[model samples]
Target: MSLDGHTAVPPESSIPPMPGFPPRAGIPTQHAAPPGGTPGFDVTGWVSAKRHRTPPAIFSLGPEPRPSDPKTLADDAIPGWKLILRAALNFLVALEIFMWLTGGALVWALGFVWPALIKAAGQEEFWATTLLNLLYVPVALILVFVFGRMGRWKAVWRRYGSPAWSRLRGVAVPTAGPVRGPVEPVDVWGPLRVVADPGTLALLDAETAQGLVGDVDHQRLLGALERVRQEPERLAALLGAVREHGAVACAHPSGARDLPGRSLAHDLLSRQLRLGAAENVPKNPAGYRGADIALDPLLLGTSLLAVGPAGSGKTTRLTRPVAEALCLQALTGSAVVVVVGAADADLGPAAWYDVVVAPGDPQAGYGLDLFGGAAHADEAAARLADALLPDELALRTESARLALQQIVGPFESGYGRLPGVRELVLLLRGEEQAWAGLLAAVRGSGMLDRHQHELAQRERMHGLADDPGTLLADRLALLDRPVFAGCFNPSAGDRAPLPLFALRALDHPLRVRIALPDHSHPEAARILARLAVGQFLHAAASRADRSLFAGLVVDDASAAVDTHAVRGLQRLRAANAGAVLGLRTLVDLPESLRAPLFGAVGGRMAFPGLAPWDGKLFEEAWGTVWVDERDVTRSLDTSGGVVRRSFRGMRALLEGERAQTESVTTRKVERRRWSASDLAQVLPRGHAVVSLTSVDGTQVPPLLVRLP
Candidate 1:
């Protein structure tokens, strides 16, 4: 037996026994043996012997079956005459009903007022009324006919339009058996049938010739095939005739002489041929790794992540891709590429990137340098006190002056007073030398120390004056452009609050990359992450319509970040900004940041990680298919060799694998890579993975680069 045109023989066990066969006590009974034979027959051995004895050969079924003409099949299936009659009947019935209603109402009213009408008709007024009433019949009849035709037309079109549209649209439909019209139209007969004229056949053949062989008029072709299937011999003859005519037409040069109607069939056939050829044509150009590596022009418009370990060639990947994108954009005159780095030393030369941002560069000033200013301010204040008060009377100065002296003591111990202090005092006192007397009195009275102390305390307390000069310089720099500020330490202390510069520079979306060491101090990293996220959110809120002035790249992010910063990052996305984060282990991700960041990122790129936990985290964060265990294994190989040498002998062993006495086999285990790539292609160093959160979702990939 065959199923769907394929051989399908049943297994021996599936074959049923004969109806009259008796059951055996122990042995399983399959088919009943031929008369008088043993009940249990060994068919397998027989089959095997036959298989060994015979060689398989390709079998040819006869020539392909010819198909019936599509026109004849359609004519046989459709009840054309019945459809026309139904339409005409519907029209008459509707007209009759309309006439009855209007004519009946008019007659009813006339009956009651006939005497009055007759009296009025003797005059001209009644005649006008009669004329108007008579006009209603024809108008009513017209409306009925129009409405009835529309209703029937809708129904008829619905039935025919589906197949016609599918055919025109090139959609495939199944062909099972002979086509048939509506069952209700069984008694109906068709009137429209034309004789098989050469001209008619030529026209149809020409049209069929125009279309490519595989370019089916889906519904029409399916219907035609179905009809032909019902009568094989008739279909075969029709196809043979069509083929013969087509060959003759092709062979005769004179046949191509443009016969007006005859060309239609050829045109259609030609179209079908072209469409078929097109369908078979390959769309993609040929290439190998180069093709795979070629950057998509579309991807240039989107953000990318290049990630690997320190020495894993992340920089190479990023530089080339980014440079390519920038070059492409420049060539196309589309957009400018701006790269902001922590410092000029970090990013290298300006020529390295389209728009390079380095620390201290005026064009990339993010905000005031809090620490730099504090150091400068301490020096200036100390110099001022040293010049105003004499050393001999310094102890006797006022409480405020003494306090100021103590504040300046640290600066004096660190760096000696500046010579400009005397010049400054002279300016304040309005005398070159006479001011020395006032200074002496104030120093002896302790007032100078007291004043200085108070001023120093105030500067430190305000955080602005401690490094006023540096602060001024940084703020002045920030006024120029956006900066990628790096806060090495983030805490509540004076230096800890340095991220405020990022908050201030939010107006200018600068790209900020923060690197934190992976050690015991996770809390510090968490705090910094929160600060970065908050700064981004604040910026996004301020510039709702513009792209975020800055983004945060936190390497080795911890759960602590989600505690406060994740909320901010989410808000930034809502406002149309972008944020990319990095994490080493998903096992440690804070739930709050995990869900939102993972959910919102537009794309995800995952690298090999330690266990199912990593995969699960990504799956939970972003709906991605779990990579095959084998593929993951192939992608991540971190095992290393250890060699030990002794006086007697030397031995080498592979890490993470145990040797057995008889054989070697490894226990299946989740693999992990030290580093991974993010969507943006920014590689992280050490045993780090890059996680990016954009308007899309979070992606974590193992770094392919080596760690420092």
Candidate 2:
């Protein structure tokens, strides 16, 4: 079977018989009839022939035993002979008691009077009896001590005499003989062993192992050797297993239908390996031969790189996997999906997604129009009121006085009529008298004309002002709706106001995705990405238990992230937040961003592209084993349509050769296509590869789904 165009090698047919072992003589070889058995020939001679069997054994009798002399028996007494004598004496005492009981008359009399005797004796007699009982206690204790010592001696003798016990103790003591000289204490410690051996250890110690373990290095080396010896096969098997499983595909687009089956095999292998399963060796399923793509779920736990030239289905693949995640989130009620693009028009409304806020054209000033209108009106109203109120009174004293009366009357009617207006009139009359007296000194000065000119200008300003009622109406209108402010030119001087309108509007948990095309711009992308991240953080902080966001998707994420920002996302991952970031090519990313971004991402998907750098980046990001330079060169040489030869003392020569044809080659190049079945098995469209690192630490393979 073949997977991803790689053929599987078949199993060996027959294992060769072991060498150097000859067939035993007289061992008859039996063969079955070919297909059908013919009439059997009589084989009475073969049946009657002596079979190879061992002869039966016959029992033999030995010489009779000799009688032991009494003197010899006494000298070589059995162990615990003294204890046996004591037991015999105790038994005789028990027999005496039984004999007395059987005699009947005396025993019956003792039983009848014993309790009455104690009662008759009274308190003083009882005390004397207790004293006598205490005397007997010491004697009984002495006897118990003597017996315990005897039992210990008997146990020691029994243990030494038992052959099985001697084997366990690793000593063979003679059962019957004059005692040998005192036994030396056995050294119970087993043979000392070292893995690298003493010579190798000394060499290593002289070289690399100098600082490894310091003074106790020898002990450490021994311990390590013990561990290695205990499980040498396990370590070897682990290394061999991962090597056989090979590279795992983390993610690949569903549109590349040719890749999923191969990708799935890789994914399965990776998962099995991660679980420490020895049986996860790669095997091509019979039906899946010729698979074009292979995926490994373990690879998804790392980062993924999707690479292709423009219009080569890179974005299509990236988005497809993301869409599938959204669908899954919807199904599980785990997340809400939001699609943010360069413009609102870029994302057509779909049922699975919600457009919280759409990106607008920065050049059109729509943001300013929406947010700045009310501010402008308020400023103008205040300016007009400041200029007109005082001047209107001076220019038309009578009209102004009448208007003031109307204003004051309304307040008076609302409250009680106030004496303040009357006092004000009296003060103005007194001021007039004082002004008349100073008129001669002020007559030739320009101050009076300047006041008159200012008064006249103010009168015109007041004439242009809207009624106070109208001013309130306009302010009320401006305050009615929320406003969205677009990006402002930060370079504009202090005169330019900060974007308070947008900031205030964002206070509510509204969605705002900023697309920063010029990531290279001084701080544009950083600012936007920061703002987006801030919103998430703010929402998370404000909510009681997190889970405040619908969802945030960052497309063309390369522009929005830097090293520091990626680190921030890594921290956010602990908060159960979901994010999807799309990149054009993983190799093109700045190292600062690449390291942290890859470290943070829980899943990845890749699309096919023609770039050696892409393969290198993928290998690094996914932790794929690097192909040996020699092996790569050999493969490439075979790949080229030329045969090279070298003769002794002659220059190498090349001969033209045709390339081997493939099933799906176009113009002598392989064509990549993903089918519907492949998509069904993995990620869907608009979502290239759907790799997910589940909460339990399992990496789910990239699901290929077609985007609607």
Please provide, for model 1 over 1-708, each residue's C-alpha lDDT reduced to its tens digit, 9 standing for 90 to 100: 111111111222222211111122211112211111111222111111211100100001101112333333333344655544555565665667667756566545555767566346446596756765676767676765565443343444544665587557642321111111212212000110122333424533443334321111211222233334456664444334333432121110011111111110111111100000000001111111001111222222112332223343333233322333332222111212233222311222332222222232334423222221123444334322322232232343243233334334433332333212222222222342523433454466555654555434534433333333222223223222222223221211222212223233332212223332223333333333333344444444455334222333333334224433444544554454444344444546544345555543433334332344444544444333322242222222224444322311211111111322233344444332321223223322232232222233322222121211
lDDT per residue as tens, model 2, 11-126: 12111111111122211112111111011211111112222101100000101112333332332344455434544444454445545544554334544657554444334487
Best by TM-score: 2
- What residue runs in model 2 are displaced by over 4 Å at the alpha carbon? 1-309, 320-333, 344-346, 350-356, 362-530, 537-543, 547-550, 624-692, 700-708
Model 1 error, position 498 (Å) = 12
Local error of candidate 2 at residue 166 (angstroms): 75
TM-score of each: 0.26, 0.29
Q: Report lDDT per candidate.
A: 0.31, 0.31
What is the TM-score of candidate 2? 0.29
State residue 673's C-alpha deviation in candidate 2, in Å: 21
